[model samples]
Target: MPSGPNSGRVSRSSGRWRWSDATRETTDTPTAATLETERMKDRYGLEVSTSSAEARDAYVEGIDRMLSAEAGVEDCLAAAIAADPGFALPHAALARQHQLYVRPDEARASAEAAVELSHSATARERQHVEIVRLLVAGQVPQALDLIRQHVIDYPRDAFALAPACGVFGAIGFSGRIGREAELLEFLEPLATHYGDDWWFATVHAFALIETGRWDRGRQLAERALEQRPSTPHGAHTLVHALFEAGDDDEAVSFLEGWLPDSDRASVLHCHIWWHYALVLMAVSRHDDAWQAFRHNCLPGTTTSPPITVFSDSSSFMWRSELAGQPRDRAIWQQVREFYEERFPQPIVFVDAHAGLTYAVLGETEQLQACLTELQELGEAGRLPAGTTGATLGQAYGAFVDEKWSTVIDVLEPLIPQVVRIGGSRAQRDLMTNTLLAAYVRSGRTDEARAFCAQVVDRRPTRPVAGFELC
Candidate 1:
């Protein structure tokens, strides 16, 4: 068996077997003791800290479920913690889940507990817990630095590497230029370490899709789903690749078949349904799109994380109006209430969508307040996305007022930097659609045609209403 900090050797002494961390030289070892020790390894072949088999099993289950966006992650992690309260990794994993679901206080406490417990853990496990600790504590830059180093040392530490992967990951929200490309570059080198691993394939596929390698991404996503059909992350990544490839019909068909088997309580369920609604809109199934939104993507209806609920609800509502559906103040109001209840501070991606909600509701006071905060954060260098959110907020306000020229002026320059705001390109299409609308409404027909032509070259379909006139 491969040996590392996590590896252990099993020995029989005094008519009993015990596991120890002492390194043993390989000599074509195929002893019964060696075989028994190998069974103690994790799914990725790393030896875990816990001696309890039940704790290790539960921890592995929780980590796999979390990576796949499956239901019962909390239950599994809690079971692991209950089985072995001193296990540091499960505490760190639970903290990540709490953070994702917007339970900041719980996240912090769990993270701190993990850090405290990690003093007795392996070096790899200690580093892993510390990375989660930094992330939950909002020390993202330091966390990212540690993540990069940790992955280099422990490439199979999937949970530790996860925060730096995908569109909403640390690199995705790094506010750095060419972050999409950066993510691809970061993941490409790690592929050899995780060949055909479902979770790795899903995340890597998302990175590929984001960087415009849709065909390859789609292939990888399909392979991932085949490996683990229950993975909502795999399904969601496939939806993104299909959306980018302009395969609306196929995307809708795939979702219809896949979603029935997915648990609605899963973390990515609402987001996956949001993708379904998007494809329905692209195919001009406006009524179906609205139904999908009201049932799955709405703030009140969705069981997703608060950030997912806020962003999906607000983005879908705004895009529905852009697609010629009448604006519903009631729906926007629900989203606003959810945002207020869940997010008391600015999260760049959620704040960007909240800007749309405020502007459309004619809540200038609230919109300006958000813009002011973003501007202040940007000025102080406190915002990772810097001025991107503020700029988009301005564009949303101008968009609502029908100041097409101002919308164009503000958004055109901001387009290149929009990736810093943190979301998949498809989500950011809310901005692109807004700019396209402005171009068409402002009678800049040539510019609209030119801009839209660029879009069609990439997407091959334009779902926005009035786009045909352009």
Candidate 2:
């Protein structure tokens, strides 16, 4: 179905976007510096803040505003930059906005400007935004510049160090691991300081979960939820914590209630859809899971390129598998090569999950490599999700290798770990279902029975994980 002029829009001008000539509610002569600020308040209704925590909030808020199609986020970012031209992020934000809109020159200029602006930022803050700017621009070399800087100057900035945790681990990246023990040293303090801030906590959660602090990550996520109960991210983190802690039943019940009342939309909608879909998939509702995927993809079908306009698309795509479907092959082929070659350094979740769609297309090698990298990340404490790339692959490997013990042994520990370390209870459904299959197939009826009992304890309302495994 084609969207008539306003499918995903919140505001429009006679069915066309009012891009430049914005409507303003104020009459003050716009300062050249704050010209964008006046336009921002007049058009989108956002406030300016210079504090670190507020910067994080503004980032999310600006992204939200852009999602609403109110005014381009660039409007508010302009205002932010006007208020404090020294702030690296406002310029970085504009660069990102330009990159998304496909203004290459502007994007490059903005990224360059971010570097120039960073001179005034604290070593930690400069290191933080530079990689992001490079990452956003797809300039991996420049991104790597900051990576080297992270290793050398002010190496303790949590944001800069977390991604560096797996730089060498990436199959395509360059480096030899010299004393891998250092990873823990770098991540511990970062995770400790990041306990309450949502984004910091999220990054730290991944760091913790990836490094094997499943219980700790869950606790931190709980702390994150306490900080901002209504923020979608907090809700997202809470779900992962519950699911990983082996509470799938509550996870499902919680999401089922939340989705109807979620009553809001943003770039993170895909996370919601995917999370819900995972719950439905656990309950063996394939149709509902598919619907969730479709909902996340709707904007992509209607739009193009960068699909950040829909939040859940990123998470949902990474979480859901698509081997049996015909359309999935088409989706895989269309973007697989581009993502594989084009992205300088892959966003692991995106690359790993996207690569899995090719499992049946004889791209098992690609999938295997992705899974290997993910396994390394999980083992080393970089990929907090503990998402076994081939949830089925582990069981199949155990079966074919006649190591039934491996299947039961491997999956038995993983179910709770997944729930505990992963971001939300909603996300852990995939783990529970995967473990249920692996346990039963490995011919460990005793453990499977225990799993059956354990799975139900999480959510008494969910039907027991029956003998059918998956």
Candidate 3:
């Protein structure tokens, strides 16, 4: 019965149970928690007086309630960050929202603003920039130190330790994140304090999937939906797990039956639907998968999105691989220019790493400079989030050289870690699949078969958003 605002349909083996049957109960039971999670008002008022610590806690709690429930409230929170110009929480909220929308610069700005506005922005938010910077610099040790320090300071805050997980995952911190207590500590208490916090449960579910505890992931994801709020993090994790677990029919049922209406949801949560598209493609439904990407980034086919979203490496990779056709090279040119606008260099990884795209485009000097910059940062520890990371560097190296096997070999082992750190499952899959197809084209099928099986096995089990088999 997972049919909340974000719930996909839930089905039972027995024909005896149906959604209509579940909805037959006349009046829906309205509760305070439900009300709290559904507060979509755009008004900004500090109703909770902050003279006392209790009032501050209440104020924070009220804001958290709205943010957790309503998507539009994100703009409100961002405005609040602007309005106060000093409160740390609004900045954190704005940063997180920016991150969700795949706007890394916005996220970085918000995180930095949070630290600038408050000296006590908590060790976590401060570490955000520090770790990202170190990752960009390619100084794994220095980056880990900053993240490890946060672990000691805010041992109970998942937000604090979560960055370490990302650092270790995407950038390769010369350590195993799954074995890191810093990450476990963050996740453990989150599952405890917010046992009811579906967002935290999403993280927990991902951890479970990583550990091969599929049953646990399934259970946690179900529990997450039971506590569904406005944001679809829980739904993203839940659907991903179901798909990964080979519950394709159930995943589809979940999406169509319980899925929320997607219009005006957010222009940037492409991960949400791209995930769904991956699952659908996995189940051999190319048509459905194509529609997912089209619905996501394709412009003004209305029920179609504005085309502005498609101009990126990530988006084009999707268009190339899953559109059940060859890539539109014209689109690639447009996307390349668009990516350039978003990632003008500052010695960042995405840009430096993206130099491979420049290399592919025959901009030899740009590629060489990007390579030189990337190596320097990786060795010295100067890059920031969305910039320096071992995986990005390694992938870029092989990518620039056109060494398909190296890309696969280097990236395969890094997948679980990067996803754990929230490096983005959709992005990683795009990179991996791109490598896989290229390998096949090079007549390296024997090498790629194992990897393709892994992709087929893994992508569905860890369901992405907006995808379902037709």
Top-lDDT candidate index: 1
Candidate 3 lDDT? 0.48
TM-score of 3: 0.61
lDDT of 3 by residue, 352-466 (tens): 2364455445566765666666556656655543333445545655654668677767766665554432333434455555555546545666665565565543543322222
Alpha-carbon lDDT, every model: 0.83, 0.47, 0.48
For all predictions, the C-alpha RMSD in Å is 5.8, 10.8, 10.5
Tens digits of per-residue lDDT for model 2, 189-258: 5443332444445445544543445467666655655543444554555565554455666677877765
Q: TM-score: which candidate is best?
A: 1
Worst 10 residues of 3 by lDDT: 41-50
Candidate order (TM-score):
1, 3, 2
Return the candidate ranking by lDDT, descending.
Answer: 1, 3, 2
Task: Mark the regions of model 1 whose C-alpha exceeds 4 Å error after superposition.
Answer: 1-39, 455-457
Query: Higher lDDT: candidate 1 or 3?
Result: 1
